[model samples]
Target: MATEQPRSSGSNTQRPLTSALAQHTQKKQWKDLSTPEKVVTATKTTTNYAVIATGAVLVAAIGYAIVSELFGSNSDTRIFGDALEKVRNNDQLQEIIGTPMMGHGEASSSKRRRNRRIHSQVVLDAEGKEHLLMRFYVEGPDNEGIAHLEMVKDQRNKWEYKYLFVDIPGGVRRAQRIFVEYNKDAGLPAIDDK
Candidate 1:
């Protein structure tokens, strides 16, 4: 007859070497760590924060650039606003097109196209000067017309109008073109700087 041996319970078994190493390397709370371990942990935390802060700053810069380019004083939207103001204030234009004028971009059948983008381009001439050419539409109670504008950068780096005109189509009378500004000496054409 063989003598029966007692079996040890699973809880009394020794953990494997890999499991023991994993437990040894597991991250402890800040207060439980030795001074050297705390230093390494702090360094990793600071690096992670720095990386997150850098990404946030990059996103902010991109957002600012987009907003400034869309709404800044030198932007196409600002140019359209200035041109619309001129059309509204002109006595001849008011007489022909009527008061309470409305200005917009291209004509569209979509009534929700309120924020339509104005057509514009920037070009460089033979004199190495910059020019902004743009087009928009103007409407009134009785008439509607197309407004074309060209602006050049002056010596002070400010935009000055080279030419601005409005063309009104006619049914009973001949088509009329009105010039709000016409600088004959600028001698700059709308050359595409492709």
Candidate 2:
């Protein structure tokens, strides 16, 4: 008999059940999220930083390559310039100057007509070798074309001409012709055209 004991207001079973329902609700909401949405959100934040870093590295590499190429020891200008300096201080030009000169090809004729004046200067080194600097002035040409030729003593103590700018028309060839003619008078072999 009697009435059952009144249930206690503080009940562990009820509390646990309520907390469990709340946890279940939170877990279901979290689990229902789309996979693609999560992935895209995460990628969007990380990819931007990754792309910017990659671009910066690529730009730096390209810049370094260009600068290294320009200033490298094996650069064409460095080697050619050094060879030209040696030619300037040699003693071969004096011996070659007195010899007969050959005419440049048909092109020279037309160029000569266009260029009304041909101005040339010669500077001698301590060894008596001559460095020739010539400029051609054309009546209608906007800019003058200049040629620099340096004659130096080779290992055989003979004179040889080295051209400063190889791209110029007849620059190296003319120097070779002059060297050959002068060396021929001295009973030496003609300069090879290699």
Candidates in order, TM-scores: namely: 0.71, 0.30
Candidate lDDT scores, in order, read 0.86, 0.42
lDDT of 1 by residue, 111-163 (tens): 78798768899999887899999999999987889999998986557678889
Q: In terms of TM-score, how similar is model 2 to the real structure? A: 0.30
Root-mean-square deviation per candidate = 10.1, 20.0
What is the C-alpha lDDT profile of model 2 across 11-44, one tens digit per residue? 6455434676677765334356689867776688
- Give per-residue lDDT, candidate 1, residue 32: 94
Candidate 1 segments exceeding 4 Å error: 1-43, 185-194
- The candidate scoring highest on lDDT is 1
Of candidate 2, the 10-residue stretch with the lowest lDDT total is 136-145
